[model samples]
Target: MKPIFPAIRLRDKGNWLAGRDGIVMAFFIHRDHSEVGPAIWRSIQAYLRAIPPGSLNWYTSADGDMVPLDDEGWEHNRHVVIERIGGGSRTVELRESPSEAGSYQVEYYGRRLDSPFHDAPATTLSFTFPTEYLVEHGAVRLRSLALELARELPLNFGYASFALVSTQGSWASADWDITEALLARYAGLDAPRAMRLSSDLGTRALAPAWLTFLGQPLLGQLGGIDALRDALPFPEVSLLPMDGDRVLVTLDEWPDPIDTRTKPIPPQYRALAQRMEPFLFQYEGEALLPYQQDMNRWIRRFL
Candidate 1:
């Protein structure tokens, strides 16, 4: 079957990390204890070569020399640093899998940035298909050509919260939408204050605004170290402070969306869709782009 990525143009949100302006890196990882070896490198080169000449490009040298798919330039190392030129200014590399652990990691940028912009590095592409195309297709497609490189491998995808993500000086100055449930629970504190409680604390209703984690067996290391598990809060029915202002409410995916009145994020079985103020990005499907460009726009649009 044909793949959906290259055939479909996915709008990238890019990363919203503020202040430190640097290149957004794209990482492709796999499990099953596969190591980056000569065979794999050759496979990658061949794969790239098969595509239309200028559609994608990878480099093995700083001068931007292409890794030859032919017998001429086939050399492998425990870890290989390949700079991907066409798809944004991202550095792609693969390391030897550890002895006992099958660990895979992916970092995605948010919305698609039109390349060759005024940015210093002139990020060309949005790291659209950074990793080997097959690896990016992942387990969903049974006949993914790139899968031949690393068979029997599973992946976990997510990206970091951009450094520019510090929002709201305090609950007083902060404007969070308050949910009816939260109004009932944190009755004493007003809506603004309740918003702080949900996010700062590990409330089940709370989800991270910076990074998103997807793929089977969501790992804490991906989205965040302290993200709430798939389990719902003790009481199935609890009011969450979605907006810290006027008792507005939204709930994350959990026991059921029945009473919440909001649909859960499909398939993933988790929803962090509530627009947290100061949130500049939406970490969806493992891509960490700027889901929302303007803070105020994001709040008004989602809320």
Candidate 2:
């Protein structure tokens, strides 16, 4: 099928300017209950090499070396540090997986910035495709090539909440949990205290209302006040698949657009809708850079 969006243009030759919310194949370190230490790391590296423009390069290492660690050296080791090639500062730290009977840990060391424009730190973002491209020329390869083409386009600024991430399960599971937790715990709280909930306890008590308005049901909707709250329109957030992809590339959380003509929408409700606009975009199999950049700008404004 023909691509809906034109190939992205890159002003910065060295770095790829990915549109916000676009999915890209990424290297992830996983720990499974199987033989060999750093085996998963090695597998992912090998996988990275097989892809076109498969330079097997590191963003951090000056030498641009690309090699996987073997079991003999890493299996028993407590930690494995994977740094980006080509002198990039990003890195990931992998530790043994933990269990009730055992213990293991992994950390995402995102980009270590010398300085950033905002108070927010540098971040590492990841997405995944299938293993078919490395093995056979197919749709996955097409997507990768399209991404590379997009990379060749101009550079633009974007912001993310974190630099490094270490999760206990699949990439999707970890990413969803972390993003939600960060949004609720950090950005949401840091937002200006509106006049509606000025009192200390009022703020605490009313906080859940905002969350509920956002489509996160704190208390189960059985009946009574909770059920009434549930009936209210709150913005909803969900991860949904794009086309036939195994993973859901898009994460949507928006205020419910349903007008409350019977009951006028509150001022804060209006603020939330205005606040969240930058983050929402319609994707119909097109280059996502513009939409992603827009969303990032909104996130930055709210942050």
**Best model per TM-score:** 2
lDDT of 1 by residue, 1-303 (tens): 221221101111232211111111111222211222233344445444534344422223334443533232223221332322233333232211111100121111111133342121111101112223334343233122323322222223222111111111121121223222322222111111121221221111223312222333233222332243233232221222111111111122111111122332232222333322233222234434452222223223323
CA lDDT of every candidate: 0.24, 0.26
Window of ten residues with lowest summed lDDT in model 1: 98-107
For model 2, the superposed segments whose C-alpha errors exceed 4 Å read: 1-3, 12-50, 62-303
Best by lDDT: 2
Tens-place lDDT digits, model 2, residues 169-206: 22222234443343333322111111111111110112
Tell me how candidate 1 scores on lDDT: 0.24
What TM-score goes with each of the models? 0.26, 0.26
Model 2 scores a TM of: 0.26
